[model samples]
Target: MRISPSDEFLADLERLLLDQGVAPDQARAAAVAVGVEWGGQSVYIRLRGPYLARAVAAAYDGANVGELATRFRISRAQVYKLLNKANEADRPQLEQARLPGT
Candidate 1:
């Protein structure tokens, strides 16, 4: 199947894949190959999958991936995966906690 992408989409994918050590040409190729187009022809394609968790863990003051991974007692890969899931599940709780009456 073919896919349609926004200009920003391709750029973002290219950047993320390359940052993950995917070779330039290979990153472009892989990002191109891994994509799905929706009814409106918008595509959501990613090479590194969910990275927000890794980013969040790293964002806490003075905390890096190694530190967060150590705290979690898991390989860096599992930390990324679990953090991704945790961010999603925590959103509702986060919103509730943020409410004025909370």
Candidate 2:
């Protein structure tokens, strides 16, 4: 599936990359590359780590699926898929966290 990232989202991503120490020019270039691929059609950009965590947290906080899809520029199905994957990955840590203090 493809995501048509919003201009705001792309700008945020560029800023994030910059914050992570990516060169300003490189960060902008990367954002632009992701934003415009396949002759100006939508492209796929995998959301991982903190991005996935935030999305899942929003869902758990009762954000509407359609709204999340629009905000994240992904389809509703992709949001569900990401949530499932995040839940699965977090299960072990969550269970461990519930254990007695270290």
**Each prediction's RMSD to truth:** 12.6, 8.4
Model 1 ranges off by over 4 Å: 1-5, 35-40, 43-51, 54-102
Model 2 per-residue lDDT tens digits across residues 1-102 = 665457777889899999889999999999888767644565565665557656555556556877777777778887787778778778999988895875
Q: Cα deviation in Å at residue 100, candidate 2? A: 8.7
Give lDDT for model 2. 0.75
The 0-to-1 C-alpha lDDT of every candidate, in the order given, reads 0.64, 0.75
Could you give me the TM-score of model 2 versus the true structure? Answer: 0.43
Question: What would the TM-scores of all predictions be?
Answer: 0.35, 0.43
Report clashes for each candidate as comma-separated counts: 0, 0
Candidate 1 lDDT over residue span 1-102, tens digit each: 554445456668889899879899998876566544323364554533445455545554544666766754557776667666767777899898795976
